[model samples]
Target: MIGRRGFLKFFGSSIVGLMTLGGYAFGYEPVVRLSIARYQLTPPGWTPGLKLRIVALADFHACTPWMTADRIASICARANDLGGDIIVLLGDYTSGTDFVTGHVDHRVWAAELAALKAPLGVHAIVGNHDWWHDATAQKRGAGPTFSHKALADVGIPVYSNRSARLEKDGYGFWLAGVEDQLALRRSVRWKRQFTTGLDDLSGTLAQVNDVAPVILLAHEPDIFPTVPSRVSLTLSGHTHGGQVRVFGWSPYLPSRYGDRYVYGHIVEENRHIIVSGGLGCSVAPVRVGVPPEIVVIDLG
Candidate 1:
């Protein structure tokens, strides 16, 4: 029923709009706007005058076009410049998924990450992707992945359901790393075989004193509830801030609790959780309202 001129106008406008959006998603949004999220925390056993800075880098899905080894090296350089007391690396180092796969020298990537310097040292934990791809390759009866070994070679201990005590200038606290929850879920399978893994929360906490202020590192924010109130703060990633938030909502959030723990700082009673938007994309390589970021938590 439409006239020729009107139909042409409408079609042309639609094409133009799609092109613009495509450009932003595929180009500008993916490359630009590396954000730094800062939070101030006053946990249980804090001396009023002393301040500690912890920088968290999460979901570095390396080897993608937008997230190259050079790009990761640059990110480490930027993080080093921040002068954080401790640097925490949340997982997802490789880009092996149904939608996309990337290959890079694990040694090279590890070397770049090894360059990062912090007083309290750099610590890390694995993510679901690491489990899915067997980044440690413990599934095939093979040993840990080259990437994991490389990280260890650089003195960055990647904890799995373990606790490490860190002290500086007579002030001390516990840093606990919980294995990825999805690592144990039977649904996370490959080639018709279940990737039976383990994430013992109680085992990780058992080494720590109940009254000691603890900072937990977990890849998925859903574990926030399982964490006892004795733990002061928890840092996490894996949702990618919903990856493509439109008007503060996303259709494809990779979370078990929907959008509840999508991104940013979340507070519950005496506990706190900071979920980073993370450094790379999955499935489709694009971002809308959500931007990749490095989170800095300052505790006093």
Candidate 2:
């Protein structure tokens, strides 16, 4: 039912398209492209006249050819010039994929991150990969994971199930960082959904003893459902914008919630959460429509 000329034409175009797509996914989007995603919001309980600019870097799966120390230092320089009051590292600092030629040392990347500067200081939290890859932490089924120690060594305080109160221009707010929701994840037959983790939302919130609005830094968006109204904003970055989103829809989301919390800002019942696309690749060193990003949030 088809002529040879017509069939050949279709085949040629198909091959070209596929090749273009492959190159974009494997080379361009993953390595060449980086974006800045900005957000402005006014959450409930936010202090009036208190404007906070937060520059968030997430999922820096640093590796040799992909994300080198020089690349990280460059990113930190860009962040430092953003005029943000504070900076937050949203975890997954280590390489998420073994498809790399060399491992970027923990100390190396942490030292590059040390270049980030802000008046309110730098804060951080650990992600699942940070816990899973640490040999001792995985063996102990707990942490002070390698990521935590690396960050601490650079004087960047990691908020592992902790909360810190901060002020900007005499207006106060709280920053709460929960332990990785999927911390110490071990591959087992019976483990799935919300199991084998170290996140303590209740205990972390209880540490907040003031009326100041709360900003929670959770590594994964899976905890967004349980976030209470007391918290003004929740920022997370484990999804990597589904790692290959298309037209704002991600086909293979790692989230249990699927596309529900796949990426970007989501508002439910007046509670808000921003799931950043993050800055590196995982499982595979490839990205298509969802290029890496640095999320900047302006809050009042």
Which digits, one per residue and each the tens of the lDDT, describe model 2 over residues 15-128?
999999999998888877889999999998888898999999999999977788888888888888888999999999999998998989999999999989999999999899
Identify the leading candidate in terms of TM-score.
Answer: 2
Candidate 1 off by > 4 Å: 1-3, 44-47, 96-102, 135-143, 184-197
Candidate 2: RMSD over Cα atoms?
2.0
Model 2 lowest lDDT segment of ten: 186-195
TM-score of each predicted structure versus truth: 0.90, 0.95
Candidate 1 least-lDDT 10 residues: 184-193
> For residues 1-300, what per-residue lDDT tens digits would candidate 1 score against the true structure?
999999999999999999999888867776666888889879765555657899999988776576778889888989998879999999888773344445656677778889899998999998877666653364453335555676898778998889988886777789999877777334433343554445678999999964557889999898888888778888999999998998888999887689889998888776788999998887778888887788888998
Candidate 1 at 81: error in angstroms? Answer: 1.4
How does candidate 1 fare on TM-score? Answer: 0.90
Query: Clash number for every model?
Result: 1, 0
